[model samples]
Target: MATAAATIPKDLSRLEAQAAGVLSPEALAYILAGAGDAGTTRANAAAFRRWKIKPRKGRRPRKVDLSTTILGTRMPAPVLFAPVGVQTLAHPEGDLATARAAAELGLTYLHSTQAAYKMEDVAAANGDGSRWYQLYWPTDDELTKSFLRRAKAAGYTHLVITLDTTLLGWRPRDLDRGYSPFLENKGIANYTSDPVFQRKLVAPANVAPLPAGIIFSGVFQNPGLSWDQLPLIRSSWDGPILLKGIQSPLDAKLAVEHKIDGIIVSNHGGRQVDGAIASLDALRPIVKAVGNELPVLFDSGIRTGRDVFKALALGADAVLVGRPYLYGLALGGQAGTHTVMQRLVDELETEVRKAGRRSHRSLSRSSLIRTP
Candidate 1:
């Protein structure tokens, strides 16, 4: 018997088909599942559908400039590849392929602290392209410092500190599978590379399994972290720092008080809290609270070009897409990922012209109409 070929569609729908063909049911569920009843996940998409673009006439441009500079770095489009962990489970190349695709497209790629590939490997693959590092704030302060030092040394210009997931949320799929990829040694690149983390381990030569207590200790030990610790991270890192997982307007105000470079308005893709407001719903107020003092980026529930447009119109300077690209990776590795990204850029460009806008600069909240 022979394995079936993974189907590749010319568009985003291909990603769905490819995922179906290539991914096992467990893998698919792990990637796609949401928290609790999954109402928030559905709400994220529904929010995008609720906002319709208000097109203008006789204002089309011969060329549309999709490029924008974010935190002193130029990106071909406002879209960035958001950091997601444990790619090896989806594809053989893992983060390396995703980095290559982002580099080729001249877009920013955010590499997760929990990436299957180490920071240096992804940075090397990036090769002068724009790449940012996402940190999970390890239980050990020394381990955290070590990861930041390595990221800075690797030429990653931006550091995104993910404030969510200090504790993992209720994910039914993972629960059903008895699956936590982290426990399987999947998304432990930064940890495995950390001198501090390694110090806690028995000698590598001995090949003894890490004690269950030790494993749980590292996993659940970050609850003492507080907002005051932002200064500690700033003191250790020497680049632009972004605070991810911010949702409230008040928190947005506080992030500016902390003097972070950017704020990612996110709800951990509704994975952390089930009834939390959709990221799209939360973006405008945060942008308003920051009041142009800092860039407000957004993530969660972005699926298509129109969704990107909706985000920008609502107040996001740029958008981070997580699962969509992962779907592409699961389906076709680098090519699949590249196609999905390009499709978004292409759609945005088309929609821009159709709406009589030449650049992202002209897009405003006025360009969107809310559903009745």
Candidate 2:
């Protein structure tokens, strides 16, 4: 007897609609909305439609291996959860649920510096799961080093330093609602719980709302941070440090010269700049510029498995998925996120089979054909 595959929604639109049913209206806007007119956000997915995969039928590999050890870590698939903060806005469990889900699936869970749950708590929930920490680079030197030290101690294998979002883009939606998650002191778990941040406090953080400047430093960015300052992290951390939010081929080349271990060619998921270059379009140039000096991961506008395929074909070593799993978290918590990732991995497997490739790594620019 032929067994049926577990039915999950293949269409992301359908899954998103389901997520919306359970999520607050404010959260829906925050997760889905982008900067300014949001041209870049929409374009991120639409740009995938521009490239077509040239498949080889009736030539499937004897066995398909979606598992990748390429990142020098044990990731069952190349797809990883992009570091998104304020996950509590989607569900009560927040980063813990997402982390647990990723751990169960043997996927890497890269959590945000501004996550609602403390790093220690999220790590506890993950329970031997592969995990990574992301940094937003606060202005204070000791605070930054404090973060790096804590993550290293907490069993995180990789350090993903976000390069964009130094000042935060002019996000019209968040501004219109006058909702600054940081100002509300939401998503500052990693900061507020840290000794360095606590020592500098004039009074208890809960006594009164912090000034905007403190919130930015204690939870988020330092636009003044520069290339000369990057070595601080390299010197402090022991594991591979990946710079996320790289876009330019020139900057990608510079990243290599700077001795960055890896670069994620992203534009903050089109949230930082309106009319930013679609990350997919920028991937080729950056890959060409740096070649194989370091791993080039891709993010921004990865909604489907075919989208994942396009990124791999275009030269992305792996792809980061953000909003989709967030949507899943909004809809079903840990189970929801697990289901969403499983579907995407299943879809990627189907893509690999259809392309007649043994694994995602074998895919290259030659596997694609540009259509007029």
Candidate 3:
């Protein structure tokens, strides 16, 4: 259905540019915008350029094992679809298309709390795929619990609590265009479907998008959220709980102190802070701090398979690709998303072979050298 009008790009590098031709001005700006000046976004790509992969001599194995397990969830490759909200902005199928693609590819798909479709619908499409739910941690406790319960019931195996977006960042592009998807009620399906959330509404979300959107923005995040309150979530969720938006070694230690399952080193893809440290630059220290106590996943500025290789070499157990796959969705819907992600995995494997590595486990800090 997605590929009917357009031929999906195989090169992958040309995805965003091609997608620009297809996306509306508003959708394009919202999807591509970074906070403030987008300096951190630029740094994300620049950080990857600072590392040079060191190919081994005559030690390449004939076969590479890209498969791995994250907190007991098995994935065919080290790549995961980072939780991207409002996918409907890019494709009509939205999370459903991505979920089906992830299921078919045997990769993990992290569904966002701000998803365009309700959790159950995406799960139905996912059909027992390795899926995780990324939470925005609403101010209302019941709403938070309701979201987790829905996710668990729908077969999502993990919980990723995004700590950065307690308040939406000052994105200049969106502001310049006087656009906000939430205001348009574009990504409120999860909330609109929630029983707890409904009690707070005067009218059904579908019937009252404007009002529902206003309430969503108000309750979307808890600025007062603290480490001590993590147990509230842990008690509600039985699966592995990973804290997304972790950028500091001190915070990584704190996650260990809180007995969290894992930490994703991300700056919310540079969408939250304009001058924040690049996620890749932050990975090595966070990995060093946490060691093997918890899995360290990475996202932000991961544009290609080589970027994935760089992340693993820097000690990330696995990596998540966000914008790249969304670009795929923008261009070809499910097939486009699949093609982009598959290309990443394929390129990652090719990079491993070229770098004389045999397995994701074989990658280490020695496999790369920091460029001056």
- The number of the candidate with the highest lDDT is 3
lDDT of 3 at 25: 92
Worst window of 10 by summed lDDT in candidate 3: 1-10
Which residue pairs show collisions in model 3? none
Ranking by TM-score: 3, 2, 1
Question: Root-mean-square deviation of each candidate, in angstroms?
Answer: 3.0, 2.8, 1.6
Please give the lDDT score at residue 229 for candidate 3.
83
Candidate ranking (lDDT, best to worst):
3, 2, 1
Clashing pairs in 1: none
Model 2 pairs whose backbones collide: none
Off by over 4 Å in 1: 1-14, 205-221
Compose the digit string of candidate 2's lDDT tens values, residues 160-206: 98988888888888888877777777788788789988887676667
Assess every candidate by TM-score.
0.94, 0.94, 0.97
Q: Over the full model, what C-alpha lDDT does candidate 1 score relative to the true structure?
A: 0.82
Predicted candidate 1 versus true structure: per-residue lDDT over 39-82, tens digit per residue: 78878888888899997888579999999998998988999999
- Residue lDDT tens for model 3, 1-372: 446225656566677888899999988998889998999998998999999988667866788889998899988899999999999999999999999999989999999998999999999999978899999999998989999999999998899999999988999999998898987888888998899989999998778888988998899867899987887897899998999999999999999998989999999889998888998989988998996799999999998888899999899999999998888888888888888888889999988988776787888888898997
Residue-pair clashes, model 1 = 0
RMSD of 3: 1.6
- After aligning candidate 1 to the native by TM-score, how far in Å is the CA of 354 from where it should be? 0.7
Off by over 4 Å in 2: 1-8, 209-219
Model 3 spans > 4 angstroms off: 1-6
